[model samples]
Target: MNGRNPILAEAPTEPMTGISLLGTTALLFEAPGETSLAVQRRIWSLAREAETWPEVREAVPGVNNLLVTWREPPRRLAAIVERLAAAWETASPLALEGRTVELPVVYGGEGGLHMADVVAHTGLSPEAIAEIHAAPVYPVYALGSHPGYCYLGGMDPRIATPRRKVPVLRIPGGAVSIGGAQTGVSASPGPSGWNTIGSTDMIFFDAARTPPALLQPGDSIRFRIAGVVR
Candidate 1:
């Protein structure tokens, strides 16, 4: 992943670069290079605008791309693509006032199963690691990996660690882990390759809630050390 920090929105100056078909019904719109929040916001804006069109069924935004599925097979794919291109051209910069969620974490103990591994790789003391990791107010790039899970960006590079060679069979929900240049919180108990540094009590998903996901793209997160969990 590039060193670019994720943000909610930035000035829309970049142009729409490329488009590709996914299977038969989905169109993947691509921006230039490694995904950034600017590209993400643009994709999100375009996806939202595309929702108004009759041809669109769903518009899923990724890091640097937007996957749009058609409501029905169009008579001419070329024409639909052309319209989408037009929408992309005129789409405004995203202006969402997303919420900032504060998650209290218990770092460096049983909850942080891979804390020692991270210390070895980064050569940073456990306390230093906790300080650096908790410093940044990470941005939600997208929701993937699991239900209500968040792919956050803006982790301090000093604490960056690679994913495990062999994934753990089961990591409990609320596990705060770092994989490659990105970091995220697992929403449910599942297999993972990311190195767990801590855990939070935040409920990421609830079926009974109006919005099942506790976090959404464009939201911000600030992690605070809430004592150690032995």
Candidate 2:
């Protein structure tokens, strides 16, 4: 776990940096090994540092990855890549303590259109699945996919389901779904490849408000079992 964190203090040596370019405009850096909260903390640390640089327009954090967008596409591409890599080597964990949100979710019916799919995959009853799913206080890892959507961590791997081979054309807001080892709630109606097992009515995005996205990195979500549809 320490090897995965960018913190040179805890980790005697950093994992080999996964560096590449996103077209000509931005650079991508992926922390090696499986996704973990420790790695994401380092990402937060790196994002904080990189965002202040004169060359960076924004430093976006994803699951074990970071995207460094430039203020302008620099001519010194090699030099920029080097600098970014150097920054990652020195980054430390930025563990954030954020607010917790409890969402009342309805599992397995219209809201959870894909509950049967999950049941079949896990060989677990809907009741058991719902119990397992709501067991943890999941941390909001990153905000991506769509406006206000939160990528959550800490799902019980027993119920881990893969993303649908054929993506749903549209899923309503607050659609709770599991994709691979991760789980998240759809912020708005849109196409998704994840399996929707439940839903909550909470408004994840509000354009009319400040800091539009409902959840920030490090915040936690507790999924309350509002009801279970047969």
Candidate 3:
């Protein structure tokens, strides 16, 4: 919610900053807390600048932070931060541009093994739940936790349910799941606490393919129920 946008008009009376050990380099940024939004905005602003800088190798945006990875042309964190701050001061945010994709899923019964649990928690029928989930197009957030993992946002509050009590160890690939207010597609067989409401046949990441991950940040995804749960 806070990464690219800052809620406060000005920096708080006391601002915090720090460094994180990532790989062989250190990432500097404002510490996480109530001011996370402000920090994230600064990070985005800096990342936008770093994008133009030759020293920075990669600038990855996250839920509330921007990761600047550098290589070869060595530079200090302070100098990078200064450059990023200047960039944030001058550059206007680019328009939100991404593709919209519709995904077909099978919900309920066996397909949505967690439907009963969801109904018990939200007091909604399986049909109602399906309708609510399929109502809106979810925005792709950050892709992580697993390769090709599509981190999505924007779900009907009615269908926003908690994760499973215990995660299944080996959820087959293409598993469509919901947790809290987000939905995602599992790109590989792995364990997760998210509620598995459906499954997709789409291959998210393939080694043999030119590009691996099917979903990217800022992309929009829609859900369409194609079959019954059983």
Query: Ten-residue segment with the worst summed lDDT in candidate 2?
Result: 5-14
User: Which TM-score value belongs to model 2?
Assistant: 0.90
Which prediction has more favorable lDDT, 1 or 2? 2
Name the candidate that leads on lDDT.
2
Better of 2 and 3 by lDDT: 2
| Count of backbone clashes, every candidate in sequence | 0, 0, 1
> Clashes in model 1: which pairs?
none
lDDT for predicted candidate 2 compared with the true structure: 0.87
Candidate 1 TM-score, true structure as reference: 0.86
Q: How do the residues 81-104 of candidate 2 rate in per-residue lDDT, one tens digit apiece?
A: 667778888989998999999999
lDDT string, candidate 1, 3-62, tens digits: 432221221234235877665677788766676677677777998888888878998877
After best superposition, candidate 2 residue 125: deviation in angstroms? Answer: 0.7
RMSD of 1: 9.1
Native RMSD of candidate 2 (Å): 7.9
- Please give the range of 10 consecutive residues that has the lowest summed lDDT in model 3: 4-13
TM-score of each: 0.86, 0.90, 0.77
Clashing pairs in 2: none
In model 2, the runs with Cα more than 4 Å from the true position are 1-17
Comparing 1 with 3 on lDDT, the higher-scoring candidate is: 1
